[model samples]
Target: MGPITSDQNAYAYSIYHLILYQKMLNNQFDTLGKLLTVTEKQVTGPIYHGLFSTAILTAHNFLTEFDKYFKADSGAAKEKIVLVKQALKPVIKEIKKWKDLENFRDHVLAHNFRNKHTGYTSVFSDSTFLRYDIPQTVSDLAILIQCIDFIGRAIQRYFQAEYDSVHTLIVQQRSGQSKKSMTVEELEQYLNQLNQEVRPAIQELDNKYGIEVKGGAGETLDHDRR
Candidate 1:
């Protein structure tokens, strides 16, 4: 078997991280949604604030990083990204409908507009200040989670193709027996762990606050708790 080339290596790197990030991003989004109800029970304000802030930052960071693999000059990278963008076109359309969320991401989530508030004698007053409504926030998170799930699955399909190709080569060298890569299995285990963490929390939230699980990974949130 020829050693993995630069393009193959890049694809593997992208696939591994894509799986890891999507799972984490899903878990964080679920945690934040549950935090909506749990904040009242927490003893310290930091627990609530920290998780919320981390999830927000992480969602932005993962999407930003996921886009970088597509920016590569490799042909495979270009083709894969094109297909991904096509697959995501519908989700993208739905996301665009939420202008308030976009505004929040632009004005607050992605960056801090400290320049406008220097020394408290701000030129712009409350009228110009950006505000987020609760319903909008919840809706934004829901849309964001769905987008992540859609993109993640599309990438997973691409990655699975790559894995199968490589596994074929590995099996060829190893004779009739087929063995999966340890790294791939480890990543899957990590994903399973993340899923486990979120399952009970989501069920608790549903039981306590009556917040429905909705769609996305939450659909299978009940399947594996161990």
Candidate 2:
């Protein structure tokens, strides 16, 4: 890529397996450098959650604004949740903590308040702000920073997985490898089967208190939901 924008686009698209996957990975992670300045400018202390919220909101908004490119509604904020689900599906199963994320997403979507943070009593009443405790020391702030980092990382990986899924399908189709390589139709069908295979959890999502989840900044729309 010749410039920052080109590099990121290449990276995002690449991660998605969309034509130039290696090109972007070849550039390494530069966006994190940018986030440093952003987080620095962000309000410090308990309100610092605003920084994370802003980051998440920015991603949500990006998805909404670029909906046409997403192959879904321009403001399909729920896609964020879906992407997160796609990315976390593996780890959740490994840790045997599947419900945690689904519940967290649901909590944030509505105005529920069950975040596990020490003082995170208030949940996403609206994607506008969140509640948290001000870290007392470097280590304290570091912990929050780590969590924020993970959140940011997740957004990217989720986007990468979805983008790759779509891009690869197209590649397969063009190459006539779709019949052999996994097609998007097949992948989705498999994912759907996986969902259907889940005998207890997804259904329990509705039966339990926290089931449905959502996130994203719906610019041309609500810009708040996701």
Candidate 3:
């Protein structure tokens, strides 16, 4: 590999943050789900609140990062952007419907600043404060998990070449060999071969996790969460 260009750096940065936020959101939700199932709310009340708040913030961060990539001038091909948008159409609609959740996130979790006249700060704040609805919020987060999964797979597919180049350069450096960049055709062949090799493993793991791959190759990988 050679010196990284500005475009590569920018692409790497966006993908890195998107994955980071996605993982955080998933972890928070997973933990919250387990906590909810246990019959120990007395002990887990504070823990649940904290985890839920973090999950909300993480979801916001994930969506914001996703929008950057989904935008018209984000350097992604127009057709790719259209496909991503179509895949995420339901998630986008739900996000638009989450006005109260957004307000709660903005006032209580993100800012924590009171509107003096309306007294909108803490959970105890007056009518203006958007009180948290645990059930509704949980349902929303569950839907957003689909968004997270789709975006994660999209990023992996869209930027496979960049990821492979970085991984190869790291491997070369570790082995004290000269770094070499792959040509476009080489990258495509590598990805095709890699997918063939990983398909069985992917299916096995999907079975373990109760994920169902419903679409053809190069299409959105859908999951039937257990």
Candidate 4:
């Protein structure tokens, strides 16, 4: 999974062990995006070395953009990463306990591979597969679910800020309107920009390569919640 090719060489390239694990982790999350339709997903670039590192990165992102979003106000949002890091801190602490479990399981499987007389069917073999397979899959899913949380929270934050900006624009217009919601003009204007200016250049990804640029612009974008 790392620069090294296989588990057989993992110990030999122990320096890159973390890199290898992260590579495998990224693959697992990529699979999650393909399998699930959920918006709240955690898809970081790779497996992290530990929870401490992750917490640090979260803090970094939060502090870097503090004033722009939070602006020293409680009502304003800093970012959803602020919330998600809080959600993840406890879970990541627990995962640290299981850090070596993956390697231990891999060692067991490698041992089995080395001693393999031949491939055969048996209840014992089937049961052993359940043992490691279940836990490995669970870890992968847990991580992916966390990724979902991270992404979903960030999107919510974006929605809030974007909403605030648009609402401010509407107020500045001071149009005599009964409702305080997005005008159809807003939707048409936004969509026209997306469909024409952006689409033409990104058509390969937008039209052919199967990239969805819509970013879950769901019904909430329609109503002005102010």
TM-score of each: 0.47, 0.23, 0.54, 0.24
The sequence of per-residue lDDT tens digits that candidate 4 reaches over residues 1-226 is 1232233232222212222233334444555554344443343323422322233233223322321332212322333435644655654454444343334333433353221322533324445433432223334555534543453344344444343444454566687676776699998888876665654455454445454434422222333422
Candidate 1 residue lDDT tens string, 95-132: 45544443444555444422233343321345223244
Best by TM-score: 3
In angstroms, the error of model 1 at 205 is 36
lDDT at position 55, candidate 4: 30
Off by over 4 Å in 4: 1-20, 36-92, 97-107, 112-124, 132-226
Q: Whole-model Cα lDDT per candidate?
A: 0.56, 0.40, 0.59, 0.39
List the candidate 2 regions with Cα displacement exceeding 4 Å: 1-25, 40-180, 214-226
Task: Let me know the TM-score candidate 2 reaches against the reference structure.
Answer: 0.23
lDDT of 2 at 142: 39
Tens-place lDDT per residue, model 2, 1-226, is: 1222432443344334322322232222243334345545454444444333333333333323333332333234346645754764553233222123233343452333444442455544433222322232333333333443444456555565545555655666789743456789989898767655664554455446543334311111212332
Q: Tell me model 2's lDDT, rounded to 2 decimals.
A: 0.40
C-alpha RMSD for every candidate = 13.8, 19.7, 17.4, 20.5
| lDDT (C-alpha) at residue 115 in model 4 | 18
